[model samples]
Target: MAGSLWYATAAPGPVLGPLTASVRAEVAIIGAGYTGLSAALRLAEAGRDVVVLEALEVGERASGLNGGQVIPGVKHDPDILEEMFGPVAGSRLVDTVASGPDVVFDLIRKYEIACAATRTGWIQPATSPATLEVIAARVGQWRRRGADVELLSAAETARLIGSQRYLGAWIDRRGGTIQPLSYVRGLARAARGAGARIFSQSPATDLEETHSEWRIQTPQGSVVSAMVIIATDAYTDRLVDPLRRTLIPVPSFQVATEPICDELRQTILPEGQSASDTWHLLRYFRLDPTGRLVMGSRGTFADVPVAVAARHHYRAVREIFPQLEGIRYEYHWGGLVGMTRDHLPHLHEIAPGLLTGLGYNGRGVAMATVMGRILADWALGMPGPELAFPVTPLAPIPMHRFNQFGARMVIQGLRAMDGLARVRDRWSARSAPGLSL
Candidate 1:
C-alpha cells in the first residue's frame, strides 16, 4: 500500500516537455487531465490551435488515480435529475450522461489507447432491501429510455457477483473499466498527433483578461489565447478562486491486492464487471487484467494516516470475499474528488472569454471525458441552450474555507449510518427466516 498501482504497471507514453517560451493559440486549456486532454484532442481535430498546460505530468492527479470505473448517468438518478432541473432539461442531461461511456470507449478504439479497456459492464449491488428498491427504480427509468440495463434477482445477483452479500443488483452493459492513467496519456498522444501542443510541468500561476483575449502566465512561459478553459477539477488552485470555492474536495482511497491465483479470480467478480454497493459511503471493487483485486472508498480530507484509512478498505474486501482473508495488498493511494452541493458536474462561464468545468463528484471517469467534448463545442460557439449540461453563472460556495472540516464530519456520520444499517439488516434477516439480507 504505497504508490499508484496504475502508474506502477501501465506502459509509459511520450512525455511532453514543459512550456519554454511564449506561445499563442486559439484556445489555451489549463490542466491536462481527462477533461483538458479530451478538449485538446477535439479542438485539434476541428483545426483549432490549442495548447494544454499541466502542473505536473499528464494524469498525475485525480484523472490517473481514480478507480477507473466507467459508470453511466449523472451522480444522481434520472428521476432525481428531472426533478432538479425540470422535464426537458433533466431529460437532456440524462441523455448526455447515458452516452458518456460510448465517448470513452470510442476514443480508446479510435486512438488505439492501450489501457486494458474492458466493456464487460458495471454492477451496483444492493446490500439491503431498501437499496434494492432504489436499484429497481433506477433500472426501470433507464430501461424506459431504451438503455441496456436490467434488474437482477437475489439469486442472479449472487451468481454474477460471486457473493451472497447483496439482495439484488442492477447491471448496465454500457459501463466498463480501464487503466485510467494509460487512457489519459494515450489521449495526450492522440491530441498531439492531431496538432495540439501539450506542456507538462507548467503551472498556470496567473490568469487575466487582457483586452478581448485571455493571458495565462506560467513560470517558464505564457499562453495568450482568445479563450481559456479551466479544466482543473478537484485540484483547482487559487488562480481560479471563484471556481475553487464552488466545490468541496473529498479524498477517495484505494488499495489493490497482488494478482490472485486464477482459481481465486474465478470466485470473485467472475464476469470481470466492476461493482459498487448502494451506500452513503460506498465501496467499489474490480479485477485488473492481471487478476489483482482493486477496491476503494471514501477517505478523510486531512492527513491523519494512510494505514488507518487503508484498514477500512482491507476490511471491506475481506467482508465481501471471505476467501481472501489474508490477501497481500500491493498498492495504496488516494485522489481528490470535486463534489458540488447538488452532486452534479458544473459547467460555467466565469467571464466573457474564460470558461471552467468541474465538480464531477465521483463520476469523473466518463463524465470528464464527455465534458471535454461539450467544452470544445462551447468554445466553438455552441449556444448554452444547445450544450449537454446547462451553462450557469459561477457562484462561490458559502464558507468554502471550512469545507474540509464539514467533509470529515459528513464522512464520519455516513460511516456510522452505514454500520447501523448493516446491523439492522442482519437483525431483520434473522427475525424473518425467509427474508434475504
Candidate 2:
C-alpha cells in the first residue's frame, strides 16, 4: 500500500543500533519522537542528566513521516472540551492548544533549529454546505475565545487559495508548516548538545519500581532512574500496560508529487496556506519548497505505487483546482498516530516513578513538542501548575479493546457518509438555481 512509498523516498539518515550494554541515568525516557526529544532537550538544558532510549533512530517514524502540516490547536473543538471537562479546565486546554504554534516557533528561533519553519498559515476549507456550517461554527468559537481567526467568504477564499471548490474557510495565520523530519532531528541534536545521552535502538522492555526509584530494563541493559517518561505514541510497546490501555494506535498515510510548474504552483495555495478539506475522512495538502505537493488522508492505501497515491492526492489537487492535472508524483508513505477516544492526549502516572505521555491524534508536531517540554519539567521535580501547560490522565475509555475494532467500523461508516454527502452536494449544486457555482 502507501506504506511502501515512504521506504522509497526517505532521506538518508543513520538508524540507531541496539543497546549492547547496560547503562544508568537520572531520568530514562522511552521513544525519541518529538515528545521524548523535546523533553530530553529541556531537561538536559536544566542540568539534568537524562538518557533517552529509542527503538529506532530519532525521526524514524511519524515524526519523520508526515505531510509536514504544522497546524496548531487540539483535534477536538473547544466547546466540545468545555462540555466534557467543565468550563475552567476546558478553557485552559483551549488556551494551551491555541498558543502551541507560538511556543513551537519560538523554540525553533531560540535554539536555531534548521527546520524549514514558516508562518504561512492554514485554512480549513468547507467541502460541502454541512461542513461549511461546521467550519463557520469553529470560526465563531475561535473568535469568541479571542483567537486570531477569520472566516472567509467564497470569493475571499478563492482569491486566497486560487480554488473555487471550497465553499469558504477558517484561516488561522498562527498555524503554519514545517519540514517535520528535520525539525525532529534538530531537536535531538539540540538535546544531545545540552548534555542528554540519547541511545538509539535501545528500547525499554520493562519499567518497574525499584524501591523509591524507577528501573528501565532495556534489551542491552537497565537504567535505574529517579523518574521515567514514555512518549512513544502509536509505537508504544507493552513496556507499560496502563499506557497501552490509554492510547489507541491508528494509521495515517501521505503522498508527494515530484514538483509542479511555477505557474501551476503559484495558483494553487499561492499564499503558502496549508489546506485541509472538511470531511470525516479528510485530505490535507501543502507545497514543499521544491514545488512538490505533499498531500495526505486518513485511509489505507491499495496496491498502488507511491505514484498512485501521489495521483490520488493530485486528484484531490485537481478537485480543488481543475487547472492542475497530469502532475508527476515521486513519494508515498504512511505512519501511525496514537489517539485517545476523546481525541485528547494522555498523560498518566502508571506507578510512583513511571509516567506516560501519548495520544496526540494527528497534531503531534506542535502538541508533542510542547508536551515534551512539560514532561521534562515534570521530571525535574517541577510542579504541574508551574509547567506552561496542563497534563492530566484522562479516564480510559470503557471497553477499549472492543473500541479498536469499533474504531475501524466507525471510520468505514464515516467514509460512506462522506461519500453520500459529496453526492448530495453535487446534486444540490446542479438542481438549485440560486446556488452559485
Give a tens-digit lDDT track for model 2, residues 1-437: 23433344434443346666667788888988889999999999999889888887788888888766777787777787777667777777787777788987988898787777889788988777766777777888888888888999999889878888878888988888878877787788788889888888777888778679887777777788888888888887667766676776766767777778887777778888888767766788888777777778774523334454445556666776677676665776777878776667766666766766778888888888888887887888877655555567646667878877776677677666666766676512221110110
Backbone clashes for every candidate come to: 0, 0
Positional deviation of residue 162's Cα in model 2 after best superposition, in angstroms = 2.8
lDDT values for all models = 0.88, 0.75
Cα RMSD for candidates in order: 3.7, 4.6
Q: What TM-score, computed on C-alpha atoms, does each candidate reach? A: 0.96, 0.89
TM-score, cand. 1: 0.96
lDDT at position 393, candidate 2: 62
The most accurate candidate by TM-score is 1
Score candidate 1 by lDDT.
0.88
Q: In terms of lDDT, which candidate is strongest?
A: 1
